[model samples]
Target: MSEPGSSVAAVVVAAGRGIRIGGGMPKQYRRVGGQAVLTRTLDALGGDPVIGRIQVVIAADAAAFFETCRAELSPAVADKLLPPVEGGATRQDSVRAGLEALAAAGAPDVVLVHDAARPFVDSELIARAVAAGRDHGAAVPGVAVADTIKLVEDRDAIGRVRETPARENLRAVQTPQAFAFGLLRAAHRAAAEEGLHAFTDDGALAEWAGHAVVVFAGDLRNRKITQPADLIEADRAFAGPSATGSGAETAKDIAMTTYVTRLGTGFDVHAFTEGDHVWLGGVKIPADRGVLAHSDGDVALHALTDALLGAIADGDIGTHFPPSDEQWRGASSDRFLAHACTLVRARGGRIDHLDITVLAEAPRIGAHREAIRARIAEICAVPLTAVSIKATTTEKLGFVGRAEGLAAQAAATVRLPEDAEADPVDAQAETAMRQG
Candidate 1:
């Protein structure tokens, strides 16, 4: 047992290759919500005032990858991090290595074992796990199972139903599992001596060692990312509106009533010059001639930026970054679109969708359509499905048909809080009520 009011340490297991995710790099190193998965996990742990020290367990060959993840962390969190130790093949072995490393450095009174892939583990859950561990010496977070679970006799192949477990008594376990430092260390050592290394979780191992483990309430949103769909869902959760204070309202209600929708349209044209290639939608295409313009002349992005500004009743691109400015000479058009997105977010608005049509006769847009769509989505920080790009020709009827220049027209749909001042009738009614 730990002494009263002793500090807490944490071990984050991030050494798994994440083969199921199928990303070339490990899933922990993959970008989630503009930051690495490991970075977000560290940030979550660092936010908790109860946790004093943190040790990360990573693969031996992932030193460079871990360093890149560390660089993205804030100074305060980075300072609390101990030098990472190399992990073993199995998760149990990796955790044992981490516990040994912590013991070598003078272990804390309590320790929490967490997964780097579960980035949504909030501070409230951590507090619950810590409190339970302090009381019970060993504790794991778990949520009661909601669905019927069946046990199969021959689990690997076609089998018969052996039994069905009561849903009320069953639980789906999650991390960060907490334990008293000395007790957990001894338990891990005993397991190694007994050659008991195949246990899936520390709670099971603790039970095997004859220690009573308590279960604490776990969060529904605290999901582990094991596949690509999980990553996509995690990203969507980050992008969606938080459900902090919307009492008794569904997500759809909050989304619909919180903002009023507006649409804006923009068109841009650029003449071809005597160079090799032209820029369109932030992608440089191999063309017969470059665009004659003050900037790189990405018609697709320029039109989209203008449409975004128009949606919010802001001025056009010329008003913000005038062609007269020397700094914008040869500047990338992506900056313009990004600035528009920033303004939308600053006003608590979201760009719901962007539709663009490119009118050109040369260079074949069909081959580059998907790339353009993806680039726009990245610039706007929206999903690819929210951005649409199409192309057409005028059948040799105009300058575009003659292959002398290209044109792009875009429409942007955005949602923002309805402006009270813009509705004069409502304002007048409110004024009358106040005066009366």
Candidate 2:
């Protein structure tokens, strides 16, 4: 792993009680726009190659919550999140916990501290933090405050005005704050030693500890949702950016059709069967003997399963419904086809079209092509236009030519949702829904 280089370790603090967002799940776990804030934060950081590892600090009881919510999260988000550590009593305590976890894992040069509640993070802000931290040892993203500063007093009583802080000199700090591992550790230790807890952010802590802190221009899109209003704003920010529900993606490129890829193939064979029926394309072909195999020996189903699985990067049929299983003995080939469809749907990839060819010299497949196609269409739940079936045979040359067994080939075409790219569940759902 080459020690992972001077990579960015994103420490996402998901420990806070987010009452404002008002979901049973914490604000970090609550869906921002359509995605959970925790999920989006993990995705944003984990998607960056510059970021090597991500450590999430959650409350002790949140483990069950995390596990339960796993299916709701995108795979990209889930894969990036390191097993979460239990956070402490305060925000600083959580930071310390995160830092400790990072250290135990062989500390990266710079660890970026962030809040999982802040889901609107973009790559540019992280890139700035990493580039600056590499040079200056400490850097944090901040946005210019548009709201006026206020030091509030008793609401019912008249209060003297507190000195107004200089707006020009102030910045509303947003994460991620990137810092050298050793420097941040020492600063936290020093803060603990002095009994100082006045710091609000990593920048403030770094300043209190006498380390030179550098600021970078942060993005407006990097807003955090601490209150209810912030959630509304976060919704607008991300939903406006979403290409899925919104048709905004079409404006960027007009020629963009939901592209469907094409693949074509041919197969033929003759089965020397003593049996009375042959399973072909999940349909039984009336014959004297079925093709020989470890399972029901449906070569047609196996080939079709491969074509469908291959389109989605899922392994072949044997990899899933192994013929080695006693359970598969005399199993209906429809089960294998159903599983293949499941994989395609789970990945949000849809089978646009599929063609299956069965070559048999015995019980001519020409009369049953429509019935086989309809059966496949029913299993895949696609329109009849999306399914095809054909059959042919050689003039007695090879094993298939000599009627030793049945042979089949399939071509599967698939498409993935552009807006929800890098997600498997959405891919799966979209595929299943469209096919269904």
Could you say which candidate leads in TM-score?
1
| Predicted structure 1, TM vs. truth | 0.57
Each model's lDDT comes to 0.82, 0.70
Q: For candidate 1, lDDT tens digit of each residue in 158-273?
A: 88999998889998999999999988888988998998788779999999999999899998878898989987766555444553211122445333224678898999999988
Identify the runs in model 2 with alpha carbons over 4 angstroms from their true place.
1-5, 68-79, 151-158, 196-198, 240-436
Please provide, for model 2 over 1-436, each residue's C-alpha lDDT reduced to its tens digit, 9 standing for 90 to 100. Answer: 2134456788888888776665433677554444456766776777676787888898975764454334445676567667889988788878888898888888888889998776656666778888888889888887788877766565557766676777888887788898988899889879878877556588789988898998888877666777777765554444443333212222333232233453433333334656788877767778877666656666666778788877765667768877688898878877777777666655544567888777656668887788887777766655567788877787777776777776888888876545534447778899999999
| Residue range with the least summed lDDT across 10 consecutive positions in model 1 | 243-252
Off by over 4 Å in 1: 1-122, 130-139, 144-149, 154-160, 164-169, 175-215, 219-259, 324-326, 346-350, 395-402, 417-436
RMSD of each: 8.8, 15.5
